[model samples]
Target: MSLIPVDEALARLLGDVERLRTEYVALPDALGRVLAEPVTALRTHPPFDASAMDGYAVRASDIATVPTVLTVIGESAAGRRFIGHVDDGQAVRIFTGAPMPDGADTILIQENAERAGDMITAMEVVAKGRHIRGAGLDFRQGEPLLEPGRRIDPAALALIAAADLTQVPVVRRPRVGIIATGDELVEPGRLRTDDQIVASNNFGIAGIVHEGGGEPVDFGIVPDDEFAIGETLDRAMAGGCDIVVTLGGASVGDHDLTAKVFAAKSIDLAFWKIAMRPGKPIMAGRRGDTRFLGLPGNPVSAMVCAHLFLRPLVARMLGTSTTTNIWRARLATPMAANEQRQDYVRAIARNVPDGIVVEPMSVQDSSMLKSLAMANALILRPPHAPAASKGDVCDIVVLRHIT
Candidate 1:
C-alpha cells in the first residue's frame, strides 16, 4: 500500500511505446501513424508563374497611370498558354490558373477593367505582380515539409499526395492483451445471479486500446483464484502481446492476487498506487518485453487509468509521442471537495456565446459506467482541495471517439 506522487509515477512510465518498429504503408493507410522521416517537395507548386484571377495580364507601367487602355493581343485559358509575349500598350486576356506570358508583370482583375472591342481600359491603377501566383508559392522543390514523429492527418495526407508521394514510412500498431479478474464478474451474455456483475471493463479497455491505435486481444474474465489469474496472464504473454492490462485485484484485499501472480511471472514492478482517486490501486511493471498494467476493479477507475496510462503507451508504441493530459473549460456549476487523492469528475461540455461551458455529471459514483458514457471531459480535483465555485478551471482528459 505504498503511495507515490502522480508526477513521479508518470516519469517512470516514460520512454518509447512498448517497442518501436517501422513499416512502409500506402498513403491511405497512414492515417494516425507517426511519420518516420520528413516528407520533401518533389516539384515547385504552380510549376510556373500563373494568373490568380480571370482578368488581363499587362505591364504595370501600362496601367499604373489610372484610366489607361491597351489592345488585347491574345487569350490564355486554363489549359492554354499564350506563347506570344505581350508587347507595349497591349494586354493578354488570361483566366485563373493560367501561366503568365513572357512580357506581362501584373494582372488587372476583370471587375476593374472595361472592354471595348479588342481593347480594354483599367478603371484603377494596378501594381506589379498583383493577382499573380509566383512559382513555388505553395511549396518549393527539395524542401523538407514534414518531420519524423509527426502524426498524419487528412490535410497532411493530401499534402503528401500533392508532393507526389504514393507511400510513407510510419510506425506500426502494437498488439495488446486485456484481462479482467473477479469471481463476481461474468461474461457479457452468461447466466448470472443477482450478486454477479457484468464483465464490462475489458470491453471498455479494448475500445480504449483501439482508440490508442493498438490491437486489443480480450481474454474474457478470469476467476479470483491465483492459478486462474496466472493462466490468463501466461496466455497473454505467450501470445506475444506488446502490453498486458489486467483489470481488478490491484488492491491488497484477501482475494487481490494480481500482484502475487505478477511476482510469480517475474514481473519487475515499476510503480504502483498513484496519488489519484478511483485509480490509487494502479500497478505498473514489466515482464520481459511486455509492459504490465494491473488496474482496480471499479469501472470508472479502470477506464480513467486506461486513458491516463494505456492510451499514451500505445501512442508511444506508434512513435507518436502524443501527450493526452488535456484542458477543460471553467465549470458553469460548482463541484464538491476532494479527499487526499486526486479525483477525476466526469463532465459534459456545451457551446455558449463566450466559450465552451462545462457541466459535471450528476452521478459520479466510481462503480458507474453510465456516467462516463455521457461525459466528454473529466475535471481534476487535487488532493485535499476544498469545494470549488462555478468558473473554476481544472485539468481534464478528453476521451476520443472509438471506432
Candidate 2:
C-alpha cells in the first residue's frame, strides 16, 4: 500500500468533524472556552453623558473667552449627577466619569479652570462637547459584544462581564483517551529492569491534549497482549471518549497488537503509514463516534505528530479557528537533501533585524527528547528538496505560543 501524504492524511483525520455541543457556563468558568453563542450588550455603556476629566461643566458660549468667571452651583462625582442646569455665568464642579449636568455642553479641564469658594474662572477657551463622553459612546444596547467561535481570554472575560453577562455558552471540551501499550514499558517513578523503559509518551500526549483544550483521560499501560488492548479500548469507548489514542504497538512487529486489537473491534481504518519521518507508523481511523489514532512510541515522534495532527483536531472539535504558526526563517547551517518522507528538523529560532534565523540541531535522531524540548521550532523540509546552504530561506512551525 502507498504511504499517505502528510497533508492528505491530516485532511482524512479531520473529516466531517464538527464543534461539540454547547453548554452554558458561568463567566468565571468560561475562560479558554470557545464561544458558541454571540454575546450582546445588555445595556448601553455610559448610560448618560459623562465627564471624561475632572473639570468644570459649562456652556460652550460661556467659556468661549479665557478668564471667564462663573458661580459653581453644585458638584457631580461619578455616581452623583448635578440636577441643575449650567446657565450663562454658571458652572458645575464635575469629576471624571460623572454624569454631565443638564444644559452643560462643554467641559473646562481642572488645569484650565481656577476655583475660589463656589466660583470657577476659566483660564482657556474650550470647544463644545469637549472632555465629555456621550451616552453609549463605548457600546450601545443590542450591539454584538463578541462573535461565535471566539476563545475567551482574560480581556474577553472582562468584556463579557461588562456586558452584564453572568453566563456564556461555549462548546463542550472534547475528551481524549490515551492508552500506552508495551510490555517493556513501566510507569514513571516505578522500579524498572535494565531492559525496560518508562512509559513517557502518554504524559506528553496528554499535555498536548490539555493545551489544545481537550480533557485527557489516561488508560494506563496495557501489556503487549491483544486481550488487554481490547479491554482497554472497550473501557475508553464506554467511558464516552471522543478520541482514543494508543501509544506504541503500531509497527509490524510481533509485539505490536494495536492494529490487531482495533481491527478485531472492526474499526474503519482510514489510513496508516504517513509519508513523514519519525512518525511514519501513525494510524488513523474512526470507530463508531470515537476517532482512533495510533502513534509511534518514540518520544519525539509522538509529540511532533501531536503538534501536526492532534492539536488541530481538538481545536476543530472546540470550534476554534486554529492554524499552525508556520513562518519563514533563514537557515543558520547547511542541510542535506531530503528523501521521500518530509522531515521536521528540530531547531532553535532567534529574531534578527532582517528576519528570524533558525539553526537545526546537529542530532536529528527521533529518540532524542532533550533536543525536542530545547527546540522552539521545527524546520520543514519537503520531499526531494535540494540541498540548502546557510542563509537559505526555510519554512518552520513555531512550537511555543509566546505572547
Candidate 3:
C-alpha cells in the first residue's frame, strides 16, 4: 500500500465521526465541559434599578449644586429596599447593590457628601444616573449568555451561573480504552529481565486522553499472543468504549500482531502508514462503533502521533474545538532538507528580546523518551523542504502554554 500524507490520514480518520450525546450536569461540575446548547439569561441582571456605590439616593436636581442639604429618609442596604421615596430635597442612604428607592434619579457618593443626624449635605455637584446601575445593565432576560460548542472555562462557568442556570447542558465526555501489546513489555514498578522493557506508552496516552477531555480505561499489557490481543479488544468494545487505542504491535514485523488480530476480528481497517517522521507506522480503523488507533511501540512516536491525531479526535467527540497551538518562531539552529515524511523535531523554545526562538534537539531518535520529555515545542518541517539556516522563521507547536 502507498503511504498516506498526515493531513489526508487525519481527514479519513475523522471524516464520519460526530459529536457524542448531551447530558445535563450541575453548573459547579460543568467546568472544562463543552456546552451542548446555548444558555440564555433566565432573568435580567440587576432586575431592578440598583445602587452601584455606597451613597445617598437623591433627585438629580436636589444635588445639582454643591453643599446642598437634604433630609435623610431611610437606608437601603443590599437585599433591603427603602420603602419611602426621595422627593424634592430628600435623600436615602444606599449601599452598593441595593435597589434604588422610588423617585431617586442620581446618587451622591458618601465621600462627596457630609452626613449628620437624619441629614446629608452634598459637598459636590452630581449628574443624573450617577452611581446608579440601571436594570439589565449587564444582561437582559432571554439574551444568550453562551453559545453551543463553547468550552466551560472558569469565566464561562461564572457567566452561566450569573445567567441563573443551576444546571448546564454539556456534551458527554468520550470514553477511551487503552491497550498495550508486547510480551517484552511489563508494567511500571514490576521487575523486568534483560529482554523486557517497562511499558510507558499507555500511561502517556492515558494522560493525553484526560487532557483532551476523555476518560481512559486501561486494559493492561497483553502478550504477543493473537488470542489475548483479540480478547482484550473484544472486552474493550463490550465495555462501551468510544475509542480504542493500541500501543505497539502495529508494524509489519513478524512479531507485530495487532494488524492481524484486528483483521481477524472483522475490523474495517482504514489505513496503516502515514507520511510523518516518528509516527509513520500509525494505523486507524473502526470496528462497530468503536474507533481503533494503532501506534508505534517507540515512546516518542506514540506521543507525537497522539498529539497530532488522538487529541483532535477526542475533542471532536466532546463537541469542543481543537487547536494546534502552533506559533511562529525563529530557528536557533541549522536544519538539513527534510525527506518525504514530515518531521516533528522536538525542540526548546524561549522568549528572547527579539522574538520566540526555538532550538531543535541535536539527537532526533524515535526511541529517545528523555529528549521528548525535555522538549517544550515541536518544530514543524514539511516534507521535501529545502535546507534552512539559523535565524530562519519556522512553525512551532507549543507543548505547554507559556505566560
Q: How high is the CA lDDT of each candidate model?
A: 0.86, 0.91, 0.92
Q: Report the C-alpha displacement of residue 14, candidate 3, in angstroms.
A: 1.1
Task: Report the Cα lDDT for residue 309, model 2.
Answer: 88
Error (Å) of candidate 2 at residue 9 is 0.2
Model 1: residues with Cα > 4 Å off, grouped in runs: 15-19, 64-73, 115-124, 182-196, 222-235, 238-240, 253-255, 319-338, 348-363, 386-403
lDDT per residue, candidate 1, 205-287, as tens digits?
Answer: 99988867788999888899999899889899899888999999999889999999999999988897999977899999987
Tens-place lDDT per residue, model 3, 115-233, is 88998899988889888899999999999888899988999998888889998999888999999999999988999999999999999999999988889999999999999999999
Q: For model 3, what is the alpha-carbon lDDT of residue 193?
A: 96
Error of 2 at 271 (Å): 0.8
Residue 120 miss distance in model 3 (angstroms): 1.0
Q: lDDT of model 3 at residue 61?
A: 92
- Candidate structures ordered by lDDT, highest first: 3, 2, 1
Give the TM-score of each candidate: 0.83, 0.96, 0.97
The prediction achieving the highest lDDT against the true structure is 3
lDDT (10s digit) by residue, model 2, range 1-403: 4798899888888877878999999989999988999999998886899999998999999977778899999999998788877788999999999999998998999998888899888999999999989999989889998998998999999988888899899999999999999989999999999999988899999999998889999999999999999999999999999999999988888888888887999998888899998799899888878999999989999999989989988988998865777999999999999999999999999888888999999998998999999999999999899999999999999997422
Single out the weakest 10-residue window by summed lDDT for candidate 1.
Answer: 394-403
Error of 1 at 402 (Å): 19
lDDT of 2: 0.91
